[model samples]
Target: MIPVQEREQTDDRRSAWAVFLVFLRLGLTSFGGPVAHLGYFREAFVTRRRWLSERAYSDIVALCQFLPGPASSQVGMVIGLSRAGYRGALAAWLGFTMPSAIVLVVLAMGLSGAGNQVPAGLLHGLKVAAVAVVAQAVWGMARSLCPDAPRLTLMALAATAVMLAPSPWCQVAVMVAAGLAGARWFRPAQAQAHEPLPIPVGHGAAIGFLLAFFVLLVGLPIAHRLFPGQWLAMADAFYRAGALVFGGGHVVLPLLQAAVVPTGWVDNDIFLAGYGAAQAVPGPLFTFAAFLGGAMRAEPSGWVGGMLCLVAIFAPSFLLVFGALPFWERLRRNAGAQAALAGVNAAVVGLLVAALYQPVWTSAIHAPADVALALLALVALAAWRVPPWLVVLACALAGWGLAPS
Candidate 1:
């Protein structure tokens, strides 16, 4: 088995910096959505840079997909953190999310119905870009993880389930359950595999960080309900939303709408409009929470308040993923565990597939031109070896002209 780089060696400033820049570029240039983000990721990380082995990358992706909270985005964070530590992860995450946050905030101030408008053609092109991006991800993941009929079927089922329920959290839960079941029942015979990456030092600290976050996530909300106005309430709302979020960004809408509308934060119009705009932008959708928070401007108002809301929403995920990552090596190879993961992974694939179709595809593919544009984008990626970033841009233009939202 090839020796994966030691943590100490991989955790260099240069590595982290590279990841930061890459994600930053992605946040600014990549279009469509999370599914598209994944495609751009593959084109850059898996295919272009060769940062991770195919299996290693796919495993991480599969795990993220099965769990929730912007699977692709989380996967990127995990990868960055794994290579560089807390700061590395932070840089990568911030770079990826900051652009969207900035855009959302700026746009938030302009939603007075008299906001400057763009040509419908441009919005439609963006949709085309989204379609192309998902197709790229589906192709890459299929080749890597779902190489066989059974695996493909598993992924298909996951997508179908999502189409039926359209509930992100449920989708994640289904995948997790399936993965755990697969690990238990279908453990592959032990063989030589990549040597486990060294656990980042002080596994205890990682666990503690995770435990503390979760405790607050569940505990603070109840405390807030009982004793409102304190930081606990703020923490509770954000953490609960973070904990429950499956697909991230747009998925956060339905859950958030229920939470805030009842509390008299913002009406449905603001919530849905922000969500749609979030889709139109290039960065993390969680930043929509930032926009919503800014709009709320209740107690912890202004940029600081928005930051708090955003931090609270994303904190649990950051903690949980890091805490679990140190142990992923141990878990991934365990037979009983592998059996469960197999099932879950398949379901995750399916869920992702469904997501690709609905929010990703349905939103964009409205015309025969869209179909053509998507096909051409695929050809560029699968055939001509073009960067996904370019494909997304081209498709966005095509969508703007052809479909003209």
Candidate 2:
């Protein structure tokens, strides 16, 4: 008979393979934005694979939702962590993100010179699809995060505040205010007892990872400023965007656009076009960075830039997840933490709501046909249960066909 340690190691290896294959399939098929990704995860991991219990999965979702990174990616990591170990987490993220990143990078490289020659209607259609996706996310998240009157009120206030004075700092401030409000007002009537969720890494490792995350967050930009290199600037820009953006992958749009476009690293048209192209692909929207990097007129363009930016943008998610996992087990059990998370989740929904209106809706719905296309996409997603990839394809084709003569 095999030794216990050897058996465990064998099991872990198998689990890692399972994680890779599962998330790779998801990378190929999952769509409709981050919130929709969460629903897919729940269906796959919780209902189908039984990798985590529904309660544990929901708790993990709550934890990721409140944190300042890509929530779906974080949740995927946590699921991977629970299933196998750190190796599984890496496998999950790589498998789920690489497909879209590769697609976008290739698109950027191939279409760098296409410019106005490319069909504007197809791009517009993807943007309209994005509108439907984000709107669906807002509706679903609102139901879960703001089901109560107090939470609903908090969400409204958060949404109103950000809509009126839209900026990164404004987003941060609203999240902070919401958390405080939750802690003060949304505390549970009775403390609930629960088992701690398992994290493969111990607290000591978590602390080291957390420290490294902060060091990179603070140190990268300073080093770039001092040393002045294209690669360093690129790394700093992507890293800062990854570290700072609060809501999700979509929320990083403006931050990333500001980072690359104004600096003349990537053209505005290429950036926006990549964003539109990103919507048609599966996996995380953060892969949009890969496209921008590849499409950049600056040095390090091509695969080098694409891979570098992709890794830089996603590195923080790994660090943040590893760092927080140990503490998450404790935080979930605390009434104050739960209350604060509730507030933050509501605020996140509001942020999604706000995002759907501005960059997504305003940019997408330029005409009556655009509005109709978006509404139909919404129906396809929310009502017909048509797969997102099919919806994206349909929208793209429809946009191409419907382009004004």
Candidate 3:
């Protein structure tokens, strides 16, 4: 770790307040999606600030990617934790999450009744932009994480399974099994050994909370079957969706689409529309839940329903990550347990690979234009050094001009 005085002397000497403000700015300025958000994070924290060494940052990325949650959001939490513990985590999360959630709320409320007030061309363009951003992420992730043939094979297998089944239960089970198998059998190309668990603090509490919440969700539907059809029914759908989610955010998209859109809780076009907009905003794509909830024209429109969706999707993840983290250390010290986690972490990578293909890549790539756009977005990102927001905006305009919804 960089020493404290030296840390203070670093060029980007942001105070706690300054850090929050910086993230807040990052949140607002973040318009493309998570891949772009990664770019932004690298620019602000690594290149500009040098707040963390490359090794420490990579370790955090490894840990975040190994765990089940939104990749960008988890990284934000780790950065916050590293910078200022719990408070930093909260600030980063809030700063990252709130902007997107708030924007979606507005769209959910106003657009529900307004119909296609957003130009069809605009929506189409945004969809194409969304595809570009997701593809960029997949390429970046594959480059960094899945280096060897075993990991690549695992990723391919996982993606195929999800594209076929698209079930949460199926996804999580695969992740667990893969991790176990990797620990027992697979080796990194260099023959380096893997750490069993690299989760941060509060992991146990997070798991306990998930258990308690799961019980409430399952039991409440069974017990209050007589209650308003709306409340209990909503609980069941969201709860089931949460239970089965594996890779978080994008992984949950198919499940959410199945639950809310097809069931008539939300219109299909509206769902895709919300998804397009979700890409243009910061924070987890799972917050698209807000669009589903608010557009249902629920009693508590705008923020209330949007907040409900936000909580339903993410609360479980926070519990799982922090709760699972603390005991993971103990598990690491045990050779067998470490062995198991070693397998688990490798499996987690497989699951991530599967997710990137099934939902993240497939859903977004709808056309040849989309493929070209995605490639161009990556080129601009990796080669030309153009800012992401600009790429997103330009692609959105291009999509509108070339392909109208």
Candidate 2 structure quality by residue, lDDT tens digits, 1-405? 998755654764447888999999999988878878999999987786666788888878877876777889989998888887888899899889999999999999877767677787776666777778777777877887789999888888887887898776687788899889988888775444444666778889999999999999999989998999999999998988788777787678766866787789886556655676687888998999899889988889889999999999988988988998778757766888878877887887787777777667777788888888989998998899787778777887888888886
lDDT of 1 by residue, 187-215 (tens): 56763344344335368987897788768
Model 2: weakest 10-residue lDDT segment is 189-198
Cα lDDT of model 3 overall?
0.64
Give per-residue CA lDDT, model 3, range 97-128, as digits (tens): 88878888887777787776766665566656
So what's the TM-score on candidate 1? 0.64
Cα-based RMSD of candidate 3:
5.5
Clashes of 3: 18
Any runs in candidate 3 off by more than 4 Å, and if so which?
Answer: 1-22, 30-62, 78-89, 187-248, 297-301, 332-386, 403-405
lDDT order of candidates, top first:
2, 1, 3
Model 1 spans with C-alpha error above 4 angstroms: 1-15, 112-195, 198-201, 230-232, 334-405
Q: How many clashing pairs per prediction, in order?
A: 30, 0, 18
Which of 1 and 2 is the better model by lDDT?
Answer: 2
Every candidate's lDDT = 0.65, 0.82, 0.64
- Candidate that scores best on TM-score: 2
